[model samples]
Target: MSEQLVEALRGAVGDGHVLTDPDVVEAYAVDWSRRFRGPVLAVVRPADTAEVAAVVSACVTAGVPVLAQGGNTGLVGGSVPGADSAPTVILSTRRLTRLDPVAELAGQVTAGAGVVLADLHRHVRAAGWEYGVDLAARESATVGGTVGTNAGGIRVCCHGMTRAQVVGVEAVLPDGSVISHLGGLPKDNTGYDLTGLLVGSEGTLGVVTAARLRLVRPATGSAVALVGVCDAADALDLVRSSVPRGVRLLAAEIMDAGMLRHVCDVASVPWPLPQQHDHVLLLETESPADGDVAMDLPDDRDVVVALDAADKARFWSYRERAAEATAVLGVPHRFDVSVPMGSWDAFVSDMRARLRGIDEVEEVLVFGHLADGNLHVEVLGPEPEDERADVVVLAAVADHSGSISAEHGVGRAKAAYLALTRSPAEIATMRAIKAALDPHGLFNPGALLPSGPASPSRSS
Candidate 1:
């Protein structure tokens, strides 16, 4: 049966594109975090949307599950097959590299799923524009994958998440049907919002092949301010001060001294501040209004303002590389959760104490987009219980009425604790939608939604 399935995929794509070599499949077997690895029947690289649809159709007919992959850079093990699942075909969109030329006048561009984010940025920048959302993984992350996860980055405070910029999506549904909504219209109140549904579905409902992304004007003038705060409460206060301001806030990032030191040591860049500070609030504002926007924070804190581009980049590099630096130090159990801005300080203090209670939790590093209350916590130890840590923090986040998973989707890592964020009725509704779309459960099995009694559907 596996042989027949491989042949069918090979026919949809090509013999050379269908990879059965264990060495070749190994790279696609595990996710970026290297947490989940599974046996894959084969890896299929489709060149175009037609090939993707054909591949999906063949897999559905063969009764083999399919895991859609783009750049294979997801942190939550979304692209990897589950360990207990049957042998499945890993669908790679690497060859779907077609990208429309940048439309400077329209402020938008349509790009295939395989178009790397960095490449897209370069193309857009050539036309004197920029993609709204940018991530540290832009070098390897694809537009489709970012859209699938509804990725949020430092710029999210200003430009919003990937979902807001996604004007249209082209995807192959679970039943091998191609749904193309590449209109890029500013207004469309038609039927169901299939585009929104698929954006954060994590490939469970459909495979995102391409997206028409909205572009925005690059900042004409920018300024950065690194303020040393005493604690999370002060950081929150600084964030609130930015509100109802004249300048456009580009990013508001908070990092501890430990995070800054680690990134500086890893990058060989000296810390910018003259004195050591426990907590640093990195604030950046950009505007087309005029010269550098005057930023005046409370006089109690030490502040360094960067009017030049070079200095601003230096400060941002530290905040942007927090996760990478932590990874370089050790593979820490990481959590990207968000609470309300009001509860940001309390939640962090509580979660920090809770994490310290565990003997295995060697160290805890906290940082994130403080403008939006999404905190990225990294914990290191001999053997970190990621799931246990997730539960502990998720419960705390719930108590504060916050989200369990912020930018990163549940994937397999947070699937077990999704109940903390969502109500039973909400989960049931999601299960029903899943059953209606993928009745055979052939697409991305064991992701996002937890497995439970099948919801009633038309087929049933």
Candidate 2:
């Protein structure tokens, strides 16, 4: 970053909050994926919305690009900073956290962008209410980052993804204007819906400061059934019949056998007997207090955790630990793709066979929120530090009519390949829309859009 940008950042946020040290900036340089790290002028930690706005405004004036980051647990290279990327400032959304709790029957709770997902769950769950999104990175992924990526985790089957749960949003436009329609009146259909436009913009459209998200009562009873299937196709059949169990089906997850072995090795969870099957699916169900069915059946599922605090944590740990397990193997290529549900059987078989035939590839681990047709793949191999494998795997997703990302935002890491799934005309429209919201291309430039790609229809 240039001296002018550093001076402006220091002025907006007190000197104590502005970090220009190479050591500190280096820490925020890369994400969990370690894919594409960029050059950073400084790391600005804002304490409140005002400070956040000030920092953003200063970056615009100085012509210094800004990258909004949260817990840095993102698998995509979205949060990474690099040196080739001109002078830039890293806006760390770490300090803007506050819990605003409302005790109404609907149980409304507003959280700051920096509040971690898991902590938000614990805060409201005591009222028999809960924040619906659950992911392995819940402990680290902040509300702002989750909203930026529209994250979908294990609960997607029953509760839906983050975008579905976000009834309101509070973001700062490129010009540092705060647009507060966060969880606004449900009946206001007077104009176009701008909240949806910003939610999945990947912080390229604007910086998300806070959100009014949907909250539901914690399931009175919950259970997880680990089922072994002979092939990937069999897993698809199970989901079609099992998901309609109504609210009882909290999540329906699938995992490859290779992943299970890694899970057993890295986590406290044990492996199955001599045979755990090549493909496995974990079906989760829930029961409300009025029904109380979960309490009545003890051996109903592979994993069950009721209102008991300890029991719930134990079962959830196993599912969320998949990321950690794969991370230990290597910095692998990961993608979140969504395809037609019916083609899952054929897609899995074909992709697995094709990947297996490649000598450059070593192992493949697949798991995700199957309910949304969103699959997460951690493609890795014996080659210890190989990183390009992720890029190759992502490009291959386009061949299957799958998205480059099922939920995770197209942060800087995926920015280079976003066009693979989106068509030329669609990309042109995107550029036009981006120009409307961020005219000079100042808001998180170089992300979500290739420097030369066209923009889409933007409302806000």
Give the clashing residue pairs of candidate 1, or none.
Answer: none
| lDDT of predicted model 1 | 0.84
| Cα lDDT, model 1, residue 100 | 93
Clashes of 1: 0
Off by over 4 Å in 2: 103-106, 240-247, 288-315, 382-392, 453-460
TM-score of 2: 0.88
Q: 1-460, model 1: which lDDT tens digit per residue?
A: 8898888888889999999999988999987776777779999999999999999999999899998899888888888997888888998888888889876667889999999999999998988888998988889999888988999988998999999999889999989999999978888999999999999898899889999989998888777889888777787777677534666888888898888888889999888677788889898777554346556676766888776778777878888788778777666777889988778878888888877767777777888888888888877774533456666667777777888789989887778777777877899899999999999998899899877544212111
CA lDDT, every prediction? 0.84, 0.73
For TM-score, the strongest prediction is 1
> Model 1: residues >4 Å from true position, as ranges?
242-244, 287-293, 297-300, 382-386, 452-460
| Candidate 1 lDDT trough over 10 residues, lowest sum | 451-460
Q: What is the lDDT, from 0 to 100, of the residue 123 in candidate 2?
A: 86
Distance (Å) between predicted and true CA of 408, model 1?
Answer: 0.6
lDDT of 1 at 87: 89
